[model samples]
Target: MTADTNTDLDTAQLPPPAEKSARALARARKRRSVARFWREYRTHRSGLWGLAGLILIALIAICAPLLVGADSQSVTDAPGGALEAPSGEFPLGTDQFGRSVLALLVWGARVSLTVGLLAAFLCVAIGTVVGIVAGHFRGWYSTVLMRVTDWFLVMPTLVLAIALATVMSRSIWTVILAIGVTTWPTTARLVRAQTLAVESRPYIERARALGGGHRHIMLRHVLPNVMPLVLAQTTLVISGAILTEATLAFLGLGDPTITSWGGMLQDAREAGAVSAGDWWYLAPPGLAIALVALAFTLCGRAIEAVLNPKLGVAR
Candidate 1:
């Protein structure tokens, strides 16, 4: 009996299975989720294509400096003159300033992508906070918050963005801020709806019963469950943000220092590239914008279908 008790005590003293830290466990789960998502995404042809296109765009953006050469910034205009035709020397032709269309297109990718990603991140962060708080706390506060969200939702997004941009300086960051601030309502609404469903689940009730605080339960329990939806929405938001930035830039609201696809289009329009049938100047930037939007849309749809199985139909 003495030996058995000592053995039992030793067993009890042994550290409990060297269990992983919560952070480590969370990381492992995230890795597993990513793997699962990739496996599922593989079957989606459009999604695969979209992913490939985005990769290609990113690669182009990264390689712009190398491809554009050392004099890219200074050599905005070609010696060949404006509205030049496509040839080996001036592939994609030249703009009104005789700027290499290919160079402008590559540099434009950097601006559009940076704006889209940063603005989407800002909007998603704001929306997630508003959504989680409103959804978790039901009552007068929730009603008020939802009402505020509704007010924003009912407003014309582009109009509000344009107003904001007009009020602020004409810069890339200003445009990003305008779009981010104006676009959060839709994301907030989506997150709130998902949060409500998550809050009503049995596990959430148990977490509450176990003396979990509001912050603890909401962050530790609720947020993870709603993240897939948030991620899917984020992709959609990026596409919208890109389009919004383009619209703003096209309307002469863009930073004069930067050259974006929309700015290219605006310049082309002003130069009568369309009327003159300068397809090279007009098509490359337009195609870049469309391709980016289409890629994000495809990815968002695929993620939505996979995460929200109810929406997964034969497509």
Candidate 2:
């Protein structure tokens, strides 16, 4: 009886197997969530291709001079090389001035991508602040803020951008600023609507009942919930900004000193590539711009699918 009692006491002193099992289960659940996210991302064909294309473009942009072995703007008066089609020496061909078209494209991508990312950041930042303020605080403040947004919404953004660019120096920064400032109204409205919906949730009401400060509720509770929507909108805005910059550049509003995809198109037009049947000059840059825009659109759609799984199968 003494021996049996001692053995029972030792067994009782051991940690609970159930607790160990629960901990292991929790770890498994965490791993499963991570795996699920990756699986969803992998399943998204458009998103995968888009990401691949963007990365390739970025790589080319980063290694432009090294890969192409020429300055984007350096004009070569190689009479024999003018309007040469794609070949071993110039993969994409030579422009009217015998400048390597491949080099121009690589360098131009750098400008387009930079403008897109910077403009999108500025737009998203301004929009988020305006949205949180207007949505979290109702009454006169909301009305005033929304009215201002509405005024921007009604304005002709391209005309306003052209006017601003005309008034300011025709530079990349000016273009970025004009596009970013004009584009924020849409983002602000979307974020505000999201914020209003999040604020009405039961947890938000509880936070209010618990005397949580406005800033606390806005930042901690509201922002995180609405971040997915903001990110999706940002992708679309980035694509729009790129297209806008290209349009501005194509219209001769672009800084002449800067090499851009649109600038290349302008040069092609000036060189009479279309009339002269020099298809090589116009095709490459046009295709690049289209491809980049398509990539962004696809990625954005994929993200939306992942965020809102109820809309369709998980991306």
Candidate 3:
């Protein structure tokens, strides 16, 4: 090849080297971001452990039924199966009807997780809309919306939930709906505050001056800024909803057909498992609920620290 051609080839090869360097730098930055998140996460040791415990419980819940090869509610009328202690045959023992407590705990995890996640999503959707409208549009609109929020805020959630569950029918979906509806008020209040703050920012004014539509500014600008708060609140709300569902189920407001942790607890209580000294019957479900709630609470706190660096405990 000619010297000129060789020189051009060399230049082309140099650009590839530069491109590789840029790519490497980008990857390094991504790694740093991940490391920073974990570092922040580790700052809150309790929260991290909580998240780990929750994840463990969820995994167990998801895998339990598959491992056991028995339906959560299956009744085995084997002699001496009822209220058996933890043994090789039955890890967490058997219920009054000879159902494996371990199996029920696992299946119940699925139900509780599903309810928590679904209810949290519902709350975020309804709350975001209400918050955006109330915060973005002041005067009569804001006043009316705020008043409605107040009405919900004043109602006792558990009491209202019982009434709703009684009226609507004792099902998982009903529990989800009741918990979701009642839970949105707190998120709405939080989102509204964030929306107001975002609306007052200089960029929002710039967007307005640039002839951006209200919808565009709100969705692109305000919503993005407030998303962190929404996410944190979502985690907290999910934990609360899960607990509430369990409480309702414990009170016999849950679907009889479902094998939920709460329902299991209710059954145990009704059968006098505690009084009869059947620790296996009550322990698994109760521990599952507590561990799941603890996990959510920790995750929420971790996310809060990540979103707000000032509050982050230093590693």
Candidate 4:
């Protein structure tokens, strides 16, 4: 190549001297942190297994329409007799309404998982906001917020949820709302502790000296630091939320029009499945609930271990 052509190529390859913006640096750091977290999380075998199970269950719920037709819920057009035991025609048998037990299980997963995830996220969102505000702001505001959280903390969560569900409409949304409101106290407390610790750091004073407002301080500094604790708490909250949904459904508080794990148990009880020794009708839903709860619990524990290696050592 000519000297002029080689000089032009070298000049074109030169990088600009300008540094990355503060926002860009923050985003890069966040991406790196998330990548590190995932790498650490994969080291936990139990966490990987639990994550796989959750993905499988979620996929099944999302693909329910393709796997089983919507007609599976039709009582009049049921493919088998009412309360039929497992046979060549019906693998999991039939419920009291003559619907295929296998179809009911699949459909129930959608509702149960929906309620669990929505309720858990709603609770965590509220909890994170409350905890951050309470921790960052002192005096009466913090006192009032903490007092409210404490009241919810001291009271029976299930009782509050039951009362809310009973007074409100009987629907999936209502169930989600009830569980979310009642189960947020623990999360709030945990996040508040983390927030307090973060606020005590030296950089917090530096941010304030540079004229950071409350919004800027909390969003830029406090929230990111406390997010790990919040994330860990969410998976644990999901398990409790699922259990609460099941309890509410079992108590006949869930919308009767839909099929859910707890609703199936309630139906089997009402239909004398237990009286007639129909194990197929009762066992599947019960086992499904137990398995889902266990999966979430394992995931939460694994996440905790990833965040705090000391906990893993303690275990």
Candidate 5:
């Protein structure tokens, strides 16, 4: 009785330690993982150089007018009229219509970069959703989705892109759409593989057992886990997208009004720059396109190395 008189410790009233909710804990883990991944990614020397180059190109694109003092859009105001050789006044020379080659190159940077980024974004957005749904649902859902993806996959991306670009208007946005649509099959395939791996993890099973709906689990758990792969794939895709845009422009499938690197090349071709010995015009845009693509490629390879260490034989 005396012992009973000692009030039982009110365990219920004792506050539980401030444990994070499952979502919060997951978010914290993701943050840590991302930090680790970034740390690993930065160690890649080629990646660092690629990052620097990309930043430089982006800056050049952003400050086009200030750096060149030439209007890319103007056809008549070129400092030196008609294919002037590179010199103090008009470096990078002039195009057929008296447009400053320097300015055209600068402005073209904006177009090419814009198309690459936007198209990659579109691919990632579409690919991620399709991949998650196909990976998680299984059975008929996965079968149908995979089949459709395979259908797109079998077709050559460049050929399909050309066909689509021909059917669509020759505009920057149209080019973006064409490339995005053609390129997503690869992204979808990659994302789906990653999603499948993620979905198989024990935490996903636990999430399923905990009464988490498909939407909740997929969005809250699956997508976050697969983002690294998606990101790396997106980087690779950007370089491809830029190349595709340039090719399209070079082939005269691009908007005639927009002054892109490809357009510059196309103009050069039309104006006989290739045959007329205008190496200045011919080389600059071509080199810019190649260098920019190389930068992205190097960065993408670095990211792939970090995410998939097996690929990092040199590292």
Candidate 6:
């Protein structure tokens, strides 16, 4: 029994296996990285505020199912009179259809947030790929790609998006596609500049000398270095995408079946709320849109500051 106890103690005291030790070290490094990120992020007051606002908005969007019911959106089953003023029963007042405006606003957040995130992601994905390829491969091929990007860049993004939206069937996906394709040139330009800077470093030459193929060099070396810039750009793109969605929806190009901020504005216009002086009907959605855009912009600036220390010092 003594020998068994000694053996067990010895086993317990032995160092961990190579794989387990490696995993533990990796986890420790990750924790340190996350801690360092938060510490740096805290120094940016604007970023903190923006993060708070975004969290609040995201939480509200997530909790829509719990906060309100489907009945609030039903025109036929509306509990309030048409264009009623704000009250305890109808907080933000009723719309033209007698549906609760507050409910519509909350529900609208879902669409705006969804479209903004998805469209921005698509835009960044395309831009990152294009930028990496363009930066890594120079010569006539890169020149042609850059010329195509410049063509898209010089054209007014809104006009191009509107043209695309007009051609496609009206739906959130169409809105996303239009915004994604139109807005990517800016990101591509930014990322391409960064990629060029990264690739110019001596490490890239060493990587090439070590038999690293194009795929290996890009994915392993170039991509990770440019990720911070990509992350910062994504926030700005989200704000633009949201605004574009609002524009498209307000112009009656949105899916007629859904409740969105721009759709609410369109409905208000059709209902003559502006002329009727029903400010409650018009204000909520407009304010919400502005706040969301501002929040994202603030967050983007803060992220840029955090990622690039020079910006942080300037602030």
- Candidate 2: tens digits of C-alpha lDDT, residues 1-315: 699999999999987999879999999998997788668777899888988998998998888778766545677544237888888877888898788887788889999999989989998989998998999999999999999999999998888888888899988999899888888999999999999999989999999899999989998999989998998888878888888888888888888888898888999999899998888889988898889999998888887787778768434
What's the true lDDT of residue 252 in model 4? 99
Residue 276 displacement in candidate 6 (angstroms)? 1.2
Badly placed stretches (over 4 Å) of model 4 are: 1-28, 313-315
Candidate 6 lDDT over residue span 1-315, tens digit each: 699999999989877798689999999998998898788888777778878988998998888888888666787898888999999999899998888999999999999999999999999999999999999899987898899999999999989989999999999999999999999988888888999999999999999999999999999999999999999999999998999999999999999989999999999999999999999999999999999998898888877888887864433
Best candidate, lDDT: 4
lDDT ranking, high to low: 4, 6, 1, 5, 2, 3
lDDT of 2: 0.87
Candidate 5's TM-score reads: 0.88
**Number of clashing residue pairs, candidate 3:** 0
Better of 1 and 6 by TM-score: 6
Residue-level lDDT of model 1, residues 122-174, one tens digit each, is 99999999999999998998999999999989999999999999989989999
lDDT string, candidate 4, 92-169, tens digits: 999877889999999999999999999999999999999999999999999999999999999999999999999999
lDDT of 5: 0.87
Residue 43 lDDT in model 4?
Answer: 84
CA lDDT of each prediction against the hidden true structure: 0.89, 0.87, 0.85, 0.92, 0.87, 0.91
Runs with alpha carbons beyond 4 Å of true place in candidate 5: 1-35, 70-72, 313-315
What is the TM-score of each predicted model, taking all chains together? 0.91, 0.85, 0.85, 0.91, 0.88, 0.92
Q: Distance (Å) between predicted and true CA of 147, model 2?
A: 1.3
Report the lDDT of model 2 for residue 80. 31
* C-alpha RMSD of each candidate structure in angstroms: 4.8, 7.4, 5.4, 4.4, 6.5, 3.8
Q: Residues 140-199, candidate 3, lDDT per residue (tens digit)?
A: 999999999989889998888888899997778999998888878888999999999989
**Model 3: runs farther than 4 Å from truth?**
1-39, 76-80, 312-315
Error of 6 at 263 (Å): 0.8
The top-ranked prediction according to TM-score is 6
TM-score of 1: 0.91
Q: In candidate 6, list every pair of residues with a backbone clash.
A: none
